[model samples]
Target: MPETSRPAHPLSADEALRFTASRATETTFFFDFDGVLSPVTDDPDASQPVPSVLGVLEELASRVARVAIVSARPVSFLRSRFGSLEHVDLYGLYGLEVWHDGDVVTEPAALPWVPAMAELAERAKAELPQGVYVEYKRLSVALHYRTVPHLGGEVERWGHEQAERVGLRIQGGRMVVELKPPVDQDKGMVISDAVLGAGCAWYFGDDMSDIKAFDALRAREAVDPAFFGVAVAVANPETGAEVSSAADLTLDSPEDVARFLADALPVLAR
Candidate 1:
């Protein structure tokens, strides 16, 4: 990432963002939860959204065609923090589960793997190192090594081995590795489908998986010259440089994300 973040494309940040704001009601905004809305922490369960982000997102949702969080987390985990924002949709576990219009809808294909994932969770807890944290989402399992960064290589090896053993898919992040059903769904597919009719879109994220979402935006721009897309990255010690390098612009932190939205509200409302 550059010392001062700038647009990787021809259009400047102000120019592209302003263009999107000008078409607020025809635009959709997608965000990642862990490091984009909430600060990354050693304890995954303790992670919470920045105090002001939810309020700003609620206000932004009111102005835009749609506001959605497309994250690696489960819908239940996302809802615990964002349920108050009625208009904001939730696409959790990378779109394997969705919460929209007061109902939770999970992908039919992913349901069959629930028991396998549950079994994998227990196996992980028993087999993995003591410092590693095993987070079990019904459709997936995350082996977190943030607290014990030194165990990353061991955890990753174990995770991949388990994934292979169970015929599941693997996703690697900052200091965590996850095993999920091989359903062919990801942030890219989620954003590609979600931005179908929107004139403009923006995706904010802070991990390796988010690069696919950035690619989706670029692909949309290639086909539709009229469609404007912005990819914003939130900085973190892990995965920050890589994600930022792929983004249109980089914000310093989740607090910066909150402030960015707050500042954009006026332009969007206009």
Candidate 2:
């Protein structure tokens, strides 16, 4: 369920954007890359952000206190896609890594788990089904069954077994399961810390992992009603309904998100 009951009549996307823009200089915007900025793809490497959204984010970074990408992808991967925006920050591996000022900062606690993750990745490649895509991040591993949907259950089972054997944490997503260091860090923790001193914060996401981010926003509102937080979910065929139901508003696609942000520029300017 949503942290707050749905309003009798919810604010439209444009209305929500304008409301957040009202506190432009004191606001922060956090976005999830896959399925939000970029369409979720079978080949994760092929995913790319909507062209117009990059320029929009650059503009937003100048107006807002912070503009960031909080994603499951590693900082290196995110940098490959969005490294050019100097003002945009990247929090990858669900906050286990960050790209700031041309340098990659990884959570020190997770560094020791690199060897474990590497071994798990190789094991996954050798044991998982032929169609399963194994993505190996230094701090985590993802098993993607998007190409063979029917194998989702098997892949998930395998991932959990591996996690238990290695004492790693499991994060489930759209036809994918991931194993990461058991560190006490996630999107929720990242957002909770980032929103400090900001009058308004907006989080855009498209999966179950992002619910934690929305919950962080709600937790803030609970403590301080004056703090305005918006949870926007980008619609997708899978997990869209569940994620959107938890969000304050929903946009149909990444293109819609681009246009939504672009439209808010003038409002923030005023």
Candidate 3:
């Protein structure tokens, strides 16, 4: 059952700080890549983490018992993006793959579905509207219409049609449509696996896909009161309605997210 109670809001810097300090000892931070740690961009491949963002994450990772980057991108892609950021663990393909201790561990169950998903995406690229760009991530497929804003509806409709035709599930985000196998691989499952047996879990994201993680965290807390944490959503203009509604606290932007983390680490360390 969905947890009926909404998580508390972190409206101001003071409230956010107090929330963090209160759960400091139990918290384990999980960040989304595209718009949480790294800035979003027209060219997804060009999006990289700002220097200050990386520095703050490094510091947080050092202080926290667990710090992970959970992204929809493939594990290898994340590895390439953050080549030597050894401090943080990488949960890629939306928790389908985990890069830990210089090695990659993927859920064997998800491996066989990758090639089939890639092929489906390739077909989507050919069938979708002219400006709709298909991103083949092996484990998942994303149709981006941020470039062709006018065709957003068509992109979504076609994405859904294709997902249905291919027996996949549709996942929508900021100007993008995604198709993934009907598996239990989501940010929520990732957080549950990573933090369920641990002290606490805090997840930060800026898109609809992230709400799953927020829901998961809260549900876990409800079931196990000892598991305490926060759910932070980056408030971008493009943030989805569902994501905003599900978030416990909303920050102004990725810059604000980095600043919050930077400020909280020192206090949490104590």
Best by TM-score: 1
What are the runs in model 3 whose C-alpha is more than 4 Å off? 1-26
Tens-place lDDT per residue, model 2, 1-270, is 112222222567666666666677788999999999999899998999999998999998988888999999999899999878989999999998988777888899999999999999999999998999999988999999999999998998999898889899999999899999999999999999998788889899999999999999899888976687889999999999999999989899999999988888887777
As for TM-score, the candidate ahead, 2 or 3, is 2
Listed per candidate, the RMSD to the true structure in angstroms reads 4.3, 3.8, 4.4
- Candidate with best lDDT: 1
Q: Evaluate all candidate structures by whole-model CA lDDT and list the values in order.
A: 0.90, 0.89, 0.78
lDDT for model 1? 0.90
Off by over 4 Å in 1: 1-8
**Candidate 3: residue 178 lDDT (0-100):** 86
Encode model 1's per-residue lDDT on 1-270: one tens digit a residue: 111232348566677666776677788999999999998988999999999998999999998899999999999999999978989999999999999999999999999999999999999999998999999999999999988989999998998888888899999998999999989999999999988798889999999999999999999988987777899999998899999989888999999999999988887776
